[model samples]
Target: MGSRQLESFVTERCRSGTLTVTEACHLFDRLLTTRDPAPTIYPFNHLFTTLVRMNNLTNHYPTIFSLFNQLTQTNQISPNVYTYNILINCCMRVDRIGLAFVLLGRALKEGPGSNPGVFNPLLKGLCKDSRIHEAAAIVLDKMPKLGCTPDLFSYNTLMNGICKMGQIGKAEELVDYMVSKGLQPDVVTYTTLIDGLCKKGLLDKATQILQCMISKDLEPNVVTYNALMNVLCKKGEIEKAEELLDFMVSKRVQPDIVTYSILIDGLCKKGLLDKATQILQCMISKDLEPNVVTYNALMNVLCKKGEIEKAEELLDFMVSKGVQPDIVTYSILIDGLCKKGLLDNANQMVQCMISEGLEPDVVTYNALMDVLCKKGEIENAEKLLSFMVSKAVQPDIVSYTILIDGLCKKGLLDKANQMVQYMISKGLEPNVVTFNVLMDMLSKKGEIEKAEELLDFMVSKGVQPDLVTYNILIDGLCKKGLLDTAYQMVQCMISKGLEPDVVTFNALMDMLCKKGEIEKAEELLDFMVSKAVQPDIVSYTILIDGLCKKGLLHKAEQILQCMISKGLEPDVVTFNALMDMLCKKGEIEKAEELLDFMVSKGVQPDIVTYNVLIDGLRKKGLLHKAEQILQCMISKGLEPNVVTYNALGCTAQTKRN
Candidate 1:
């Protein structure tokens, strides 16, 4: 074919998606052999652009790069600025940003010095990889050297990236820098800052930025409003979110489907499904069709409330409305079904997802695996994991973690360890939560030293020990009677800026109580209160039981009264402790009065209650009263256990004696 004919053929083939990469190379060689090469850059640019449009850059880059190399050998065609731009974007898409800069040098040496479009892709890639500091350096340092003057879009990209990295402070500085450079921040810039601030829980600062945007006549769009509303919703400030929604409407910035979806999601998260439903209806009334996200939000709430039938009905309603369910939709339903112990329905949902051509992603498989693991079907979970690999849907960290957790629960530590190794081989670094799960299992199994070693290993691997990690370690050490080590660990937690929470305090107090260090436990309780760690019911119950066991009934009663004074109503267990102490002291009248008090407080006595009261009355030779108590226990629908029968038999034997 002539050069012109070849170029036309390639363009048409590329447009029609009929040209393979190899065929394009053959056609390019034919064009180069022609006396006149009919602008090979155009055909090459078209092909590269087509590859980008396919959104499969990582898969296609090798094939396209091979063709580029062949054309370079011939030296019959040179890539223009457009060609470089396409190539730079392709590199960014695959996170091969370093290659993008090398190409930028080639473009600079060739012709048409690099521009923002070339560098923007690099910034995007860096931001996506959370390399925001490097991205900023490129914007502020490298771009100027390349004669690429960073524009508004460039600054906004950097700002958005910084915000996503959770460095809202740095983002604000970037905004200031943009202002100093005379590059005006637009709605996108302000909205990005607002989102970053809100996510950081600096909602007041976010509101100030929103107000600043309004003052600049930027007139916050639906995106800006949605960002603010999303933050408010997540903070459980539903009233504020509702007010913001009303303000957005009052401002006449016509709420889009995304705006309504954000509001619905916020309400659903706050467990206000009825309000979320109202928003859905309002959106429908306004002729704004609810998308899959909107339906998924409602369905998630229904599933969590264990209203699986209602969730399914919402799914049907969505399908009827021609809103197709994505992987998230199916995953939500599957998770809900699994939580409700309807494993069969969950599996059927997976099948339905497959039948509808919606391939179950890792999340879908994780849901199934999690259910199987919880049900003790560990072998079945492993089979499903193998199936996931066979289907080419690579198991993620969550998938391996689920199986590891299941195996650990089933006491298959060796197999769980193998799965961890397998995950590492697959290049998946176990996250802190995954490490925590394994560590928890080890600790519970009395492998304190192994658990400690694992903790150290996770730290070396760059997984920062969170509160849960320290809690697990401390709990394990306490259980092993390594109380001094556990106490030192608490000091380490404080040094690490992790304030001891109620769980941490409870663990310590329980150990002290067990060791009969009542005075020390009391001192620790005081210290915990001083540290602003309010003692939970578990903490009080532990102390009360400890005092009662030591025959310090008055002290235990004092603690009980203290709990009540703090507005903490004693549960049946708490009352039972005090009653057991009184019964042992032969304070039969006091014990009876306490029982009446518990019943008046609506704390229904259990089998333990009847057992203690009957034993005390029988010891005092009140066998008739004890029998009457047994009749009352039966009438109260509390089943007496062997302890109750044994105590009554002792009373009869004593009466005969």
Candidate 2:
């Protein structure tokens, strides 16, 4: 047969999907040995495109690269534009865009016949990788030189890329550029900007763009409505999202699976599970099938509400309806079961996942490990870690962190430190939480120097300590009575752009109050106010208790008035401190008046309240008043504990003497 006949046969076989690996090899041999001397690029380009298409179906993207290399190196046939386009597409799909660009440069050098078809794939690949700047450069600067002008698709691709990167302003500018070039902005262009603005919380601008699109007579598609609905749902504007859904149906734009999924997820998040389920039913009635994501949303909500059995039933229901359960389904159920202390059932879930041929991912293993660690079953958690390694599933930093936290909780600081070193050896740099957990444990054990060493190590490893880390260090230093060191640490944290939170201020204030440094504590309170950090109830309580202990009852009373003026209602602890002070001062009638005030303020007196009053009255030899207070305590349904009995017992002994 002639070369043309052989080429035609190859094309027919490739197009019909009848080309096997064995047959492909035989056809290449015929092309190579053909007596036509110099072959046209037709056969080579045809074969390459065919191979790429077949690989795409099977997800064998790497195979396309290997085949392309073999054809170029072994065969002396020059490739055409079609061949380059197919190879660029294959490279892009396999995340080898760098290699795709190299082929593109080669194509540009060969010159002419390069069009939007050749360039659009590269634009899309770059856009998908979030290389919007590079993609825009190619369209504006490179396209004109290559004799390939930018089209509406080119502008759309770049705008979409920019929007995804949250540069909505740049996307809008690109749209203006497209319009200036006499290219009309379509529904897709408007939708892309809307989605980006919505994600960036610039919903007003997104709405304006939607209005502009409508004015331009560009009818919004399902995708456009879906994007807006998604944003509204996320913003917790369920009512607005529902109105939009109604409007979409009124306009006869059919709601797809995504529309229902978004609405269902929104309602579920708002804790309206019944409403979410009704949306699910409405979707089914409309002949739309619920996918794994739709079911996963419901299952997640059920699990969170502690309705695990209902979630489990939903899982079975989905499976019965031919919807396969994914890793997320099992993970949610496992987490729920673990929280409920159903470790045995959670283990069974793992086994069930494996039995269904779904290999448990790191997330699944982490969930199980975290539960075991919390239960003080570190040994069992270690065994599971080994099992994960045996299955060739690499354990993530989360897995190690869970184990470290477990060891720390069990007071095994040495073992936990060793685990941190092991994590480093495995090249999994400990995150801020990992370091914070270790530092917190070490500091609590009176190993402040060791905790500081860990902090330095974390800095050396390029892990910036977060607010939680600073708070932990501050709390630890305060506990150890290292006030100067703790103060210096707070200064350093503030200088590093970390604002001192309520926890930090409270820790310092508490330490000062306890050390009788009332002056310094008051100054700290002033500083906190200047910094706009409102003093909480604990702050005022600390001051009141400190003043009362100092025997300055008048000052303490004034502070209580100030706390109440600031809208910080004194709690039971605050009242107990004042009552105890009054009883000790032999002012029993004044203490009784304070008790009446507490009751008027709707603060029920606890056992301590009654005990203080009864002890004071008994000490004053007012035995009848003490007896009346005890009877009132009994009437309030408060059963006296050992402390209450001891207080009354001491009073009775004094009376007998």
Candidate 3:
């Protein structure tokens, strides 16, 4: 047979999946030895592609590299762009990304002119490593300059990676760019964007995309519906999720395990344990048995809700249905038991899981260690850290953080600092939780400057501070009366897209009020509202208390009425502030009337309320009226403490004088 015929024979076999690694390699040798007219690069490309496909099973990746080297040495045939693409795929599969880029540079400079097909795999490698910005630059800018503009597949790949990072806005922008360059968004594009929107809790935009897909006659598939349903379930819109499922069924799109699992998890999160169980049964009736992931999702929510008994029963039921409980299942129950303060039960669970040959991972050890630490059993928690190491379970950030937190709780600053240094030395950078703990420690000790420096250190290490970190620092700044710095930090967070939450606003407002900047505090309340942040009870209470302290009785009562108008009933503290102001003005009757009003509103007055009343009546020399107030306080099953006794003692001393 001619070289072309032989090459065709090999390509046909390789493509048909009948070609073995040995046979493909032998055929290539025969093609190479037919020296009359050596086989074209087709056979070599096919053989390389075939070997790369089997790389996962036979570890033939290195063999492909050696064979390619052999082909180059033969000088009978040169590698084609297809050959380079296969090599790139192999490099990516083994995570040799640097080598893949080197091969790409060679393919661009030495091989036949590059095409979008050649750049796609390189894009995939860069994206898989989360080198998104680099990937975007190559596909959108670098490749097009080489006359290889990104195709639909190329755009879809970048979009998927961008979506995975929860960068939905950038993904959408890429879609517009793709369309501007004449590539239309497909179902995969829409589905990926939906998933990203769901992650960011942008349900309205996701649903709009869903409708847009249907409007374009692209046909919303099961994946699209699952994405939409998953978001709905997460938002506690279980009814809407069910309606979506019904809509999916009406469109002849069947719900898969993922669709049902999302629903089950959503129901579980909403504390509808029974509803979640029914969905599990429904999926079973449809012959789609619940997998380990489904059971874990259900049990995890149950465990989080402190329903350990229900979670255990679910595990038993899962096992009875021949579905094995995995490590996550046991970890969830163990965590729940530990949180419920059932350490012995947690230990027994560990032993039981070990007997079943399921080794405890770092997460399992963290759970046990956390409970022990919280119980102030730091020594026992420390031993657990060592025991996990003995079992070949390496400590993760959480394990060390749990230990450090225990030491911190016990005021072992030096030990906790050592643990942090040890983790850093081991190449595990501190995550937001670890940094938050450190920042809180410094902030509480009035080390605001050091805490801010630590924030800068965290950013230098590429760890972004979350809202909790900002809240801690802002609160610290407010405590140190660094109002200007605190305000600057709030603006900094807003610029970083970390919008000020109620905790952030509350901290700033309380500080402003303390500095007698009540007007500025009121302006902040208006600012938070303009930003769509609803003022919570704490926010209202702070304003009322602030006004009352400034002796603005009429203004304080007006604020109280405004709070009630907004459907926020004043708590005892709000009432106590108002009554204190009235008592200072010698309006004992008005203060007593305010107490009766608070009781009528079902806002139970604490001992502080009774003490305020007794102190007011005693200063007015109405000892008999103070005694009636004490009797009233005792009648409500309330105990009088030091403040109550002090007020009554002054009344007796005044009578003797």
Query: Which candidate has the highest lDDT of all?
Result: 3
**Which whole-number lDDT from 0 to 100 does residue 132 have in model 3?**
96
Q: Write the per-residue lDDT of candidate 1 for residues 40-111, one digit (tens) a residue.
A: 578878877776776555777877667667766777688776777787788887777778888877777866
In order of TM-score, best first, we have 1, 2, 3
The global Cα lDDT (0 to 1) of model 1 is 0.87
Candidate 2 lDDT at 544 equals 86
User: After superposing candidate 1, which stretches have Cα over 4 Å from the reference?
Assistant: 1-185, 192-212, 235-240, 271-289, 305-323, 552-657
* Candidate 3: tens digits of C-alpha lDDT, residues 79-103: 7778887888888888888888877
What TM-score, computed on C-alpha atoms, does each candidate reach?
0.67, 0.63, 0.61
Show where candidate 3 strays beyond 4 Å: 1-244, 267-292, 306-324, 340-345, 348-357, 409-411, 553-657
lDDT of 2 by residue, 227-268 (tens): 889999999999999999999999889999999999999998
Best by TM-score: 1
TM-score for candidate 2, residues paired by index: 0.63
- When sorted by lDDT, best at the front, the candidate numbers are 3, 1, 2
